[model samples]
Structure formats: structure tokens, C-alpha cells
Target chain A: MIKPELLVTPTSVENVEEVIDAGADAVMIGEERYGLRLAGEFDRTAVHEAVKLAHERGVKVYVAMNALFHNDTLPELPDYLAFLDKIGADAVVFGDPAVLMNAKQYAPKVELHWNTETTATNWYTANYWGRKGSARAVLARELNMDSVIEIKENAEVAIEVQVHGMTCMFQSKRTLVGNYMEFQGKDLGVEGRSKDRTLVLHDPERDVKYPIWEDWNGTHIMSPKDMCIIDELDELIDAEIDSFKIDGVLKDGAYIRDMTGLYRQAIDQYAAKPEEYIEEKEAWRDRALALQPDNRELDTGFFFKETVY
Target chain B: MRTEVKETAAADKRVITKKPELLAPAGNLEKLKIAVHYGADAVFIGGRDFGLRSNADNFSIQEMEEAVEFADRYGAEIYVTTNIFAHNENMEGLDVYLREIEAAGVRGIIVADPMIIETCKRVAPTLEVHLSTQQSLSNWQAVQFWKDEGLDRVVLAREVGMNEMLEMKRNVDIEIETFIHGAMCISYSGRCTLSNHMTARDSNRGGCCQSCRWDYFLYEDREDANAESGNALFAEEDAPFAMSPKDLNLVQSIPKLVDAGIDSLKVEGRMKSIHYVATVVSVYRKVIDAYCADPDNFTIDPEWLKELEKCANRPTAPAFFENTPGYEEQMFRNHKQKTPFDFSGLVLDYDADTGMVTLQQRNHFRPGDTVEFFGPEIERFSMTVGTIWDDEGNEIDAARHPLQVVTFKTDQPVYVHNMMRKEL
Candidate 1:
């Protein structure tokens, strides 16, 4: 069986190299103008360079063009896809059907990873996109372990699952933060809109703080807890899952490398000797906990817990 | 490159020259009839399973057949929503249900998941498959993608603007449906899982808890030392942070939309009252007709906005239609809507000779309360609540019980399903 590839969302081209060195099998990079909620973006030249750098080490690179495009931005997508194809991007992660359509027209060689964020919940939908030429389906983070296993068992395409990251709970096209600041008769400068500002929404009733930020796309409210599945990697590896994705969009370059390294080590150990990996999970959890941000908490997030109405 | 695709498509389909269908939501059979009576060209209903509005009183298969039969009488169409992003468990009995709705004469099925779409195409080939707005389709290529996949129509996302719709109409050959009036999702419709994370209710699978409307305090995530220092942004003294958006109202833009030849104009809210369905459907019906009948001299009526405001549960703005909504389009202090009008009663019967109209009381009403009566065909008229009579013909001063049969004298002739509202 093929070992599950570790996919890391890189914070920069240099970070892409750092993660590859730390044992990431693949890295995802994008430009802020096209991608949604990226940690950092690369220019056209940087993206070209990143692909070349990753390919040198036999690491694959996926470009994110997952924004919900309006007609105004859509005409430019074919050119963008052609550019990604020309630069030999291994795949293009997409949430909108238009991205797949444009890629089919202009970038047929580049693979398609259907990541609608929350809609790819079942195997039938995954296979449906697969038949339409998508090479992989990123199942929704809302699914539990049972659902994920079921999808992977029945899916015709490759499956990628989020193993560790901050999950986005809410995304809007309206500038909600800007709208609120304007309502309060205050000015929210560029600094206020930056994701590095450590903005969070506190639900006083629940006593939880959710990280919130605004970008060119709109407002994004993240979950209060990040997801860590180091201990759970065995079930996925045993299931022969195609890929494990680590979202470094909200973390630093060091966090990305360390998390990637820990997961890489665990995956290898679990794939090689399941009993030995099981004995080492407690220490793995502690190591992961130590790397978590001071204001953020970590949990297993919808993987073990069945979501109920 | 884009214009070349447009020219080739324009030569084949003159989609924009036709009259747009006015679609409305119906939670049950009663609301379905009310929507059709109020002049909806098409009505979308939900069955007992697979629809997003599970909390609503969705229809059974028998009720769906009856709804289709009833809608057909008025030359209107019935579309069923099987639009849930299906989990594996939800996939059971989906094929059977799609075939049943098709056999019951449903004109189409609005679907979000490809499982449902593929199932409908395989088992119920006669039914038109519409891609739901839950897919958040905002561009022509997405429309073209679904069109090639054998779907008939695509409901554009609430975030799409007028120019985008026009561009889609010019470029794509499939029918385009746009939301004109309704509560807008703060997040893109299907992309949000705030409810799933916050309350353990899956938003994509018909279990939305509306966590976006819940109260939350805003703050910056500073270090533990500074966390308690109150670095809250976008908050007044004690107001809860509100993410609930203003409802979409496109009454003023009816002429532009009709002129643009958009295929269907939809109103969102299956869980709303029959009175809301009647009022909103009728207002849009009138506006669309008035504009289409004489496009050169069409003007928006101020009374239409007043009628819509009477039933709206939130402040209304032209969200993503004329412009990108901003401060005036959101409610930041409180998420709740405040309106003075209460839907007081529904007309059951009208007798011209005795000057008596029977009403099933919906809200509390007593003698001397000023009330307004309106219906699908009835123009708005105000009257003072006079002497009331119970079903037993005994004299009564008030109709205190809910849905209790009450009779009142009205010199003006009223019809069935006419509604009565009183200002509070």
C-alpha cells in the first residue's frame, strides 16, 4: 500500500522549502488575489520558483484558486489556469465549479482537487467530481471518522483529509468587519484588516474565542479549537488514505515545519509498526500541544464527535 | 475570448426576451396555495426528507401530489427541494423519494449534492434538475458546467451583483434564478459550518442552528496577560456583536431585472407565515407585471415597499444587487427584527347578503382595535374591529383563542385567504 502523502499549506516560498525538508510530500501555494484565506501569498514569479524548487526535491506543488469567483474575475481565470499549467503545477485546488471548468479548458494536464470546504460530504459527490476529471476530493471537516472512512472506502478518486489546522467556521462575501467598524463610526485601517492582528470573536455565553479576520475576499471566523489528529493517523493510514493535509494558513513557518515533521514521523512509524506508534502517541500529543498557539486550543474536531442537530 | 463565447451563445438562445418566473417558497400545502393565490408563477416546496429546512412543516408525498395538482390548476409549476449536501446516512431512500416526487408531477427538483442530481437524472429523467443556490454559483462557467451536466437552471448565489447576472445571461445558455427578497446568509450559503462547530448541528445537511445570528462578544486575541484588558473591536458599550445581515429587498430594481431578462426571481423563507408568503408574492407579482406590461413607463410603487416592510423580520437592503452592501445593510447592535404589524387573522368565508366574514384568528384581537385587511386580490383597507361573533353565533367582544372561528360584519366584500393585521 502507498503511504499517505503529507500535504502542507506553505506560508511562503521559503516556507515551502522548509516544509519539504521537514518531510512534506506536497505543498500548496497561492496568491492572495485568487486564493481564499491563505496564510501568505506568492507572486507569479515566486509561484514559478516554488514549483521549480519543490520539484527538485520530488515534492509536488498544488496551487489554490478556490475563491468563489464572480463574473468580473472569472474571465481572468482561464489565463491563470494556463499559467499554472505552464509552470507545471501538479494540481489546482478548487471550490467553485468554474475553476474545474476553466481548468478543463486551459489546464487539462494539471489535476483537480475538489475542496468545496463543507459540501464534499459523501462518496457519491466525490466520485461525481472525480468523473468530471477531479483527481482528489477534500472531504468536509464537519464529517466524523465513520463518514470519512465510508467515503474513502467507496470513493473512486483520491481522498485528502485535514489532519491538523484551524477550521474556518464562517466565510462571507460582505466586508462584515469593515461594515461593523463603519457602523461604530470608527476607522479600520489596513492593520485592522490584517490576519496577523490576532483578532478574535468572544462568545461570552460559550466562553470561547474564535479567531476572526478580514481579507480582500471577506470576513472569516475560525473555530475556537484547532484540530490535531496525530493519534488518529493510524486509522487513516490503515485505511490507506491518499493524503493528509496540514493547514498552515493561520500558523507560522516554524509551526508548519514542526507539525509536518511530527505528522511525518508518526505516519511512517504507524505505517511501519502500528504497535510501536500506538505506544508513542501520548508523547506525540504533548509535542503537538506545546506547538499550539497560546490563545488557541486544540481538539479532535468533528473527527470523533458525531455532529447532531 | 469571452465575447466570442457570448456571440456564439447569443445566436442560439434568446433567453433574456422572455417573461421571468416569480418563484416563492411554500412550507406546507396551505402556504403553497397561498403563494399560488398571490400570483407566484412557480412555487418550490420541500418534502419530508432531504431538504435543508427540516425544522419546517415539510410536505409528505401525498401532500406533494396534491400540491402539484393544485398548482397545475392555476397554470403554475411546483418544484421540490432535495437540496441537502447528503451524508452517507441521508443517502438512504433518496432514489425512491426522487422518483416519487417525479411521479407526483413535480416540475423539477432543486439539488445541491451531485448524488441527488445524478440520482434524479437516472431515475426521474423527466424532472428538470436545478442547481440550488446552496452551491454558491456566482459565475457563468459554473452555470455552463452544470448546463453541460444536464441541469436546466442555476440559482445564482446571493452575493452575485446585477452586472454579474447580466454577464451570465449574456454568456451562459442555462436559466438563471436570483434571490430578490429574503434573509441573506452572512456567510456564503453552503460554505459555512458555524453551526456545526458551535452547536454540533450540521449546516450542510439540513441542521442549521443559525449560529451566525447568535450573540457573541468581539475581542482581539491578545496574550493571556492582555486578554482581560478589554481590547474589543467593533462593539458599543454593551451591545453584542451581530453578524446577522439585513434581509434582501429588490423592489426598486424590479424593472432592471425584468429588463435584463433574468429567468426567475425567488423569495427565500419556507418557514415564514402564510401572510408573509401572500404579501411578498403579491407585491412582487404586481411589480413584475407592471414593469413587464409596459417597460418604457414602468415605475416602482411606494406602497409595495410598505407592504413588504409590514411582513419583513429584519431591516431590508438591496444586498449585492445595486451595490455591495455595507453599514446600511447590516444589523450590528441587535440581530432581531422589529416590526409593528401583527398578522391577526385569516379570512375563511365571506357572505355578501348578511355582511358577515368568518375569520380564523391568528393573533389576539379585541373590539375597538384598528385592523387592516388585504389579500391576493384585495387592496389594503383599514377598519375598526366591530362586534365579533363566535361559531355558536353568540356575541363576543374579542377573539382571544388561536384559530378560533370568529365572525365580524364588514360592508366591504372579502374573500377566502384574505389576511387581517393590526398595528401594535
Candidate 2:
């Protein structure tokens, strides 16, 4: 089985070295203006420093600029793309074509990764954008294992899959939290918009609480369970996926480091000796579960589901 | 009212190169015919497979052929939806499905999946590829990306505002379609998975449970030290949270839309009733024609809005058109939509000599109830029901049975497919 690159999202430029030491082959960082629900915002100076530090350690830096850009935001992409290019970022993760257009003109050297959140389900679309210039496609988390393997085999571009962390269940451009407060005739202002407020939505019919928050972009509701695929690493690596992404958005530095270290051990052990790793798979799963937040459950997301719709 | 609109429009004599195409939804073969009869320039329908509206009474290949033929006679085009975000499993028989719809004489296909788009382009070369709004095309460069790839048209995302659309038009030469009226998804189309996560229904694959409209109790994280110590702070009684957006209504913006050279104006609802399809399509049709006839002197008829209210389930607003919507655009307290009228019946036939109008009953309507009769060709007029005869010619006081064939006397003539509705 080929070893897949373990991609971990870092909380800051200062956190880059820590995650790399924890065994990250690549680090993804972005500014809040362009990225949606990023772990932390890195300014232009920080981006340059992060790239230099990651490259020195034989690691790659992927910049996140994947917001659905409106007319007001599209014009700012050119300069940002140029800066990423100047700093030699490995790729610019994007969902909007405006980013692709601006990158082509301003930073032709930077690689493009098609990550349209939910639309990149099959290989043909991946290849479609691959033909246009995307170097990789992030498969939608809604896909099952069979679909992922099929896409990995057929797509001309590299395939990246999210193997850990909270999954966004819904994102709306409307400031739902702020609107609720206003509708209530209460002005919580900063408290209402702050992501640190730890807001959640509880459906009365179900005994689950979905984490909800508001940021500069809009409202985001997260799933009740964090996707922990420690045991499934062997399957993805055996399938020869290009990259294994561990999203650290809304997570603490300790969580990112622990997850990166565990996934790294699993991926390495599996590659080194598949039989030995198989024997110890349950132990690895337990260790990962022990690290998970008490409030959040852990599941394989849609990977093991027999059916989705 | 028609004469009055023309009189107001006569003052402005500017000519547009083309009047925008009026697109409507067709949940079934009947809705297809009704939309065309009511003046839809194009009608989008979902075939039995690979569309996002699985619950709709979608068309089969045979029915699609019939719909295409009927629409052709009226010079209206038919576009079938193969717009599901397809998985590898959904890819089976898709090439054959594309060819089948093409052979059925579908003018185009609405698709979001790249495989479907590429397959349609390869196997069904004759069918135009209209990118579904599920892609959330908010900028011109994205439109240009598809245009460069050889797709024919792009349906602007509901979140794309008017200024953004105009910018896109200035930048791209491809056909542009905008949703003039419909229910708005609070999240960007195809970006939401609340339904998939909440109810095991893949909204991208068309089994949407609409979990965003579900009532929920809001609370701060209980694990936080500052979290309210008791249920008093985050109880369901503190007003349940809902993110359901009001429906989009752009009737008043018809002149601007026409003047902007938008290629098509679409109404969104495949699962809507026949009455809804007719009323919405006809109102847009009337407003578009009036504005295009005289751009400068055009004014929206208040009656058109009133007619829309009869079928409106949710309150309507011009969402994301003029500006980013605010608190007013969402319904947080309650999600259920209410309409002021009930669709009473559909006209089956009219005997002019005997002054008899036969109706197919939909909802309960009794004798002495005043109902309005409106058709594609006739002016709307109210008639007081006097005496009714059942299919057997027995006089009945009320037409309570669904789809019951009943007859009434009216001096005015009516045609088949004409609708009757009563105030609720």
C-alpha cells in the first residue's frame, strides 16, 4: 500500500512547527476574509513565514481561499493569489471559479484544488476541472468508501479526503444568530457573532445538539459527531488516495497535534506492516476515541453507510 | 386591465432585442401543458430518474415525449432535469437515460453533476446543457468557466443579487437564467447537508427532508462555564429557532429584469399544484409582456400581486435582489406557509349553446359560493355558483368529492384547463 500524505490544518503560523513535528506532511492555513471556518486567520506576513517554515521541514503549505465569492469579494482575490504565489504555497483550496480565474492570471504557479464542499462527488467533474487546471479534488464527505475508491482510481487529479474533525452540516450566508437576537429585541452584538460563544441547536425530537456559530462569512452548524477514521486509514491508504486531510477548524492546538500524531502512526504502521497494524486497529481506534471531546461523538460519517439517500 | 397596461406602456417605444424567456416548473404532464397554455416560453420537468425532485410526479420517457410534443405545438421548449449530484452508483444507465430523453425530443437538460453534463454533451449532442442552480454560480468567472467548457446556459444561484447578475451578463455571452419567483434555500444551493445529517436523507440526491424548517431549541454549549444554569434560558418556549427564508417574488422588478437583458426568468416549484403553476406563470407572463411592450411607462398591476397571494404558501420578498436580506427575510417563529384561497376546480369543457360549464372539482365548493374563473386566454371574472349537476345529472348542493365531474350554468364561455378558485 502506498503511503498517503497526512495533511493537517494548523491554527497559526506559530503552530506550524508543532504540527509538522507531530507528523504532518502538509499544513493548510488561510485568512478569514477568504476562507470559511478556518482554524485561524493568517495575515500575509504570517502566510509567508508559515510557507518558509513548512518548506524548510520538507512539508507543504496549502492555503485555503474557498469561500463562495460575491462580486464585492471577487475583486480582492487577484492580490491574494499573487501573495500565495510569491510565498510558494502548494495549492489554493477553492470552491468558487473566481478564485481559479484570478489565480490563473495573478499566480499561475500556485496549484488549484477543487473543493466545492458537496458537489465534487464523482471523478468526471474532478477530471473536468483537472483538465482546466486543478491539481487535486477534495471528495465530498457525503460519499461512501466505494465511491471514494472509484474516484481515486479514475480521477486524473489527486484525491484528498477528510479523515478527522467536525463536519459542517449546514452553512448559510444569512447571519442567523444575529437575526435571532435582533428578532428577540435584544442586542447581544459581539456575543451573538462570536464563534467562541459555543452556540448550539437542539431538535426536540432528537437527543442531539448540533454546534452552531457565526463568523464573518455567516452561520455554520456543525454535526454532532466528529469523523474519526483511524481504523479506516488502512483502507484509504490501500486504495492509494493522494492526501488524507485532518480538518482542525474549531479545534484546539492539542486536538490537532494529537489527531495528527495518531493518524500518522496508523498510516505509517499500516504501510510498514499491514498485518501488524490490522492486529492493533481496535487499540488505535480506542486511543482516538479517548481524545475526542466529551460532547462530540465519533463516527465514520458516510463512509461505512450502506446507503445515503 | 390589459388595455390599461398597454396604454401606460405606449408612452415608451423603445424596443428590446429579445423579450426574456418565461420558464416554469412542470411536475407532471398536466402541469407542463398548463404552464405552456399560461404562457411559459420554456418549461423544466424532472424525468423519473436522476433529478433532484424525487417526490414530484416526474415524467417517464413516454410522458416526456408527450410533453415535448404538446409544448412544441405551442412553441415552448422542454428541459428535463438530470441535476442530481450523482454518485458512482447513480452513474449506471445514465448514458442510456440521457439518450432516451434526447430521443424524447427534450430541448435541453438541467444538470449539476460533471459526469451528467459531460455524458449529455457526448451522447446527447442535440440537448443543450443548462447548469442547475445547485452549483451556486454567484459570479461571471464561474459562468465563464462553464461557457468555456461548452455548456449552453447557467441558472444564477438564488443568492446572487441583481447587481452581481448584471455584472455577470456584462462579462459572459452565454444564456443567463434567474429565479424570478420561488422558495429560497437559506443555504447556498447544493452546499447544505442538514437534511442528510439530521434525517439520513441526501438533499443533494433529492431526498430532502427540509430539516432547516424544523423547529429547534437554541442554547449555548452546556459544557461552557457561563452556560445558563437552567432550562429557563434555552427552553423551546423562548421561541423556537427556524432558518426558513421567505419565498422570492420579483414581479415588481420585471421592468428592470427585462431591461437588463436576462435571457430567462424561471419560477421554482416542481412539486407545486397545477393551480400554483398556472397562477405564477401567468402573472409573470402578463407582467413581462406589459413591461417589454413599453419599458418606460410600465407599472406593475396590483392585481397581479393579489393573484399571487392566492397561491402563496410563504410570504414573498425580493430576496438578494436589491441588497443582502436582513432579519425580515426569514420566518423564525413559524415555518408553515398559509394561502388565502383554495383551488376549487379545473374546467373540463363548456357547452356554449346550453350555457353549461363542466368542472372537475379539486377542493370543496358549495352552491352560492363565489369563485373566480381564470384561463390562459380569458379575463378573470367572478361567478356566483347557483345550481350544480353531478356527472349523473342529479342536482347537488356542493361539489365535495375530489375530482368529481360537475356542471354549472354560466353565460360566459370557458375552455378546458381553465382553473376555478374560491376565497378561503
Candidate 3:
């Protein structure tokens, strides 16, 4: 069971079935109303349909409503949660304390999963949130496996770790694109190249490029490569991590299917013959590489970093 | 020690709003003292461990004790930051560190990690906890939630607009704190990982190399069939939007901030100089006092903006307080910082008998040069640099070298640490 319940990011309702069929045990959806990945979220009807499809296949559906909200907007949350409750969302993933507190009050029946953006970098936070009635917490992707194992050893709450994804290095509420384009004498998310998602960024001295995108809300400076830890499944299993999540909510169903299929095969192969996992590692890597999206490059992410400092 | 722990509830729904405390950043002990001297009601600082400002000359335990005593004399509060998003390795000494600072008479602790907040409840139960801007508490519910969790104050996110802050005051009865001045983070405070990825320096844990402020340019994606490896690499020279944001100056908005029931106005600079600490603190202090005294007749003193401009390293912008800052306000072309004002000297002890004030020159100055001596009490007083005595008590025409201690005859008395800036 520690091999991780393969989780897939199903951005739209139409992709839910593909994600499940591709062998994902769970589906994470970003609702259009809340959460960070607003560009890749499902509307009310879409999320309801997605949740229904996942549930029919015995796959869990987690709704991402992690957007930081103000008091004026918080009053409307209970109604949204009630809608999620009616649709039977397996869990509500969020990143704000108010969201956690409000979810407890309004939608107690819906399992609350605190996203890592809440700064759950240590065991204490997970256990603290567990005590506060949150069902699970996502471990910060910043933490390496050594730290992850240490957290899992002491934490009371069930924890999920991102095994593969487009890691966001920076996300801000300030719409830098919109504001910058206005300076360029253009509109934000409108007109020319300002709206284009391929606006790559480079470190002042470093020649390497990182992808950047801006929407109505804000900007995200993402990693140039997607994080792929298919080879590190053994380490996560050894750490007893609750789930392995693959992030790319804005990606299409084919992306979800390919990623989900690779992880599914990796998990199964490791399960059947644990000793052969290491020897077959490169073989599995090749299999995943064959299915890897042309736009994305893959690396181990923070899995091998050993230490944060 | 005065804690900011007002009960988050009152009979009238609004918490008994005191005049918002003028909080300043203290990179080190000198800066801490300068902040208090310049009319800061409370000062937030980082210790050598667990604080986010890795580059700053952070306080040691000995310095924390001294700083707490210094702040206490002026009836001001001291908040220590141990706000790192701790990994398993960083958590071991955290309780002991918290207890040590608490024993040092720190009035409060600013923390972003909830585990640290929970730890504070257990380890230093008497001390107040201020939720750092890193927590990104944008709404009143978030403020209320932290208050419910036993936090004394919530430093709301910079992205939070004026209306939201005001709404938080009306609904959320916590001590709401916001950055009224200083640097604006391009990413949500404490949420950035650009430094971590680019330099292996964790932004949350402190080694933020400030990758957001780095220069960058955009290029379109490569064509799928013959995708070149390096074509997306610098299709242009500079990004129109990706430059570091200008430093935030909210001194003009003090009246409106006060009207919105803010409990504290914080200036964000721990890695700043003592001169910067003094000038910024003094300006905000004056603005806060002026507004509180005559809220109805309040008008932004034009001189305050001029004073802020002199102190600032980057162009000043109002941030999201008025609205989302426009391109004109947020974006900058040249990323390098500029120092237009010369902080020439620090005011040393004054000798009434000889009518001479002892001073240490930070920058060079000439004999008979008019230098402005400004501090908490004295806003602006120009005095001619008369006969200057060197460190060995030799009279010289000019204080020719930086950091040279010189004594000069003065008609008006000057307080210690009063900045002497010769306009450059």
C-alpha cells in the first residue's frame, strides 16, 4: 500500500475517465472558483461530472480550492463546499488556515487535505493539522526524501507527496504580466505576446530558462522541466508516504493518460518484484521517456537532494 | 514586556483600536536601537537561526537581550522572527531557541510555519505570536482563524487590498498588521522558490538569493518537428514585466490605513542599514502621529515623500493598497539599487561645555559643509560642519575619511544616532 496510490491530475471533467482508465487510483481536480491553477480548473458542472466518473471507478477525487481568500469572499465558501459535498468530493484540498477552519465548520463531512503551500514542511504541522481535524496534508515538494521519511516517522496525519509535476518556483497574487504589458502599451492576457504562456525567464547569470505564465489573478514562474520520480518509488514506499501525486492540472487528457500509465506500470512492477526494482530502473525510465510529453523535460526533482540546507 | 495580545473581540465588534504601532525592521542591534530611537513602537528582528533574512546581520541571544532592554525603555515591543519553514533537521533546537528568546523578554514572535505557532503555544505560552506575511493571510477569515488558533496578530499578505483589510477590521477582530513600507515581494511573501531552484537556496528556510529580482527575457516555444535545444533562450534582452518590483512607500496612506482599523504598520527591511532604519521609522512615526492627532485635517506632507525618496534604494511604489500597482509603479528597467542620499555620519554624544557634538562619519564630508542631522525627535536641522577633530583629537579641515570620529561645534543639540546626510 505504501507504493503510493497513483494520483493523476484531471483538469477537465472529460479527462476523468481517461485518468482512471490509465490506472490512477485517485484524481485531483482544481475547481475553477478557487485554488492556484485557475487556468486548468473545472467548472461546477465539470467538477461534478469528474467526481462522479472517478467515484464510479472507485477512484478518489480531491477538489483543489487552495486560493488565498479575503473575508469578503469567505462568506461564499460554505455554499461552494455544500456543492462539493453534494457531488461527493473525496477530499477538499486547500492551503489557507481560514479555508481549513471554514471547511471544518461548513463541510465537516468532506475530508480536508491541506496543500503544502500551507507550509507543511515538517511533521509537527501535519500532526498539528491532524489534531485540528484535517484528514491529510501534502508534504512540501521542497523537502527531500530524507526529510520526508523523518516527517512520516513522526506525523500522525496521512501525508501525500508530489512524485511528478511542473514545480512552481514562484507564484504571486500581483498580475505582473497585466501590469507589465500595460507598461509595454498593451493589455494583459490580451493582445500580443504578453498573453503567450511561453514567456521564459532566465536567472541573471544563469543561461538556463524557466517557464513563466500570467493570468487574470497573478503570475507563475515554473520549472523548465517537470519533476519525475518514477525511479524513486521505492524510497517513498520505504518512507510509508500515503500517496504519490502527479501535478499538471493544465495539461491535457493525453498527458494525464501517459503519466498515469507510466506510474501505474512502475508501481506494479515494483510491487511484484521489489528486489528487481533497481535493476529494472533504467528500463522503466526508458518506458516513461518514450511517453514523456515533447514540451516537458524530466528530472528527479528534490528526491535525491538529501538535505534542505 | 508589552504584548500585542488584545482580545480579538469587543462589545462593539471592532477590537479596541489603538493607534497603529509603527513597527520597523532591525537587521542588527544598532539598527534596533536606531528604530526605537526613531519612534518605532515595535521592532521585528531575526536571530541567527530560524529567521528568513539569511543575508542580514541577525541578532545573537546576547544582542536580543540588549535589544529587548533597549526597546523596553521606550515602552516599545520587540518581536523575534523564527519563521523558517522548518524541515526535520531544523526542528530540533527550535523549542530551546523559542524559550531563549522568550526569556530575553521578546514581546512576540513572528512565525510562518503552523508547527512553530503550535510550538509557541506549548514552549513559550506567555509570549504573543504574530503570523508573518509569509502565511499569506489575505482574508478576514484567515485572520480570524489564526486568532482562533491563539495568534496575537496577523501580518496580512501584501496582495490584500485596502477594502479587504478594512473588511477584516470590521469582521475579523484580530490585531491586523500589514507592510506599510519597504520592499514588495514579486511572489507571495514566503511562498517563493525561485532562489531554491536557481541557487539551491530555500526561500522559505532563508537562503533566498532573490531570483525574482533577476533579469530575464521571453522566447517562444520551439517547433515540434525540428525543436532546437536553445532557441527559447533569450529571444529578447529584458522582460517588460519580470523585473524586481519597486520598494513600497505607504507613508501617504497612513490616514486611510488608520481609518481602516489597522493595529500596526510594518516596514519591511531587516537587511537594511541603520540610516535606512532610522529614516523610514522616523517618517512613518511622524505620519502615524500626525494622522492620529488630526484625522479630519490630515494631508500627506509632501516633505515626507521627499524624505522617503532620499532614504529609498529603489523607486517607490504604493503596492496593492491603492490598487494593483501598474507597470509604471511596479516594473523597473535597471535592477541595480541607487543611493541618492549620503548618510554621512551618526550623531555621537554632545558636549554642552564646549558646545561641540561628537560624530562618526559614515561618508566623507568637508569643513563648513551643511549637513542635515535628523532623528526621532529632530526632523531636520541643518548645521555647518565647523572645526572637525579627528579620532586623536587633532583639528582638521574636513572629515576626509569614512567611519572617522570627529567632534564639531554645534549651536543646536543633536541626539545620538541622529543621521547626518549631505545631499549628493
lDDT of 2 by residue, B225-274 (tens): 22244432244456777788899999999887876778889999999999
What overall lDDT goes with each candidate model? 0.86, 0.86, 0.78
In model 2, where do residues sit more than 4 Å from their true spots? B1-12, B15-17, B224-236
Interface Cα RMSD, each model: 1.7, 2.4, 3.2
Task: Give the TM-score ranking, best first.
Answer: 2, 1, 3
Each model's TM-score, in the order given?
Answer: 0.96, 0.96, 0.93
lDDT of 1 by residue, B273-385 (tens): 99899999989988887766556567778898898989977888888986778878877666776666999999999998998999999999988999999986678899998
**Candidate 3 lDDT over residue span A1-309, tens digit each:** 456788778756767787788899988876545777542568888888887788888999888887767666677798888888878888998887777877777777899988855277888888888887788889877778887888889988887988887777777777665566666665543544332446665443665556666654477777767788888788788777888888864456687778888889888878888878878888877877776767667888877764343
Q: What is the CAPRI rating of model 2's predicted complex?
A: medium
What TM-score quantifies how close candidate 3 is to the native fold?
Answer: 0.93
Clashing pairs in 3: A70-B139, A71-B140
How many angstroms is residue A46 displaced in model 3 relative to the true structure, after the best TM-score fit?
Answer: 1.5
Off by over 4 Å in 1: B1-17, B225-227, B234-238
Predicted structure 1, TM vs. truth? 0.96
TM-score of chain B of each: 0.94, 0.94, 0.91
Residue-level lDDT for A158 in candidate 3: 86
Which tens-of-lDDT digit does each residue in A217-240 have in candidate 1? 788988888899998888888788
Q: Where does model 3 exceed 4 Å of error? A: A1-3, A187-196, A306-309, B1-17, B223-241
Clash pairs, candidate 1, are none
Residue A138 miss distance in model 3 (angstroms)? 0.9
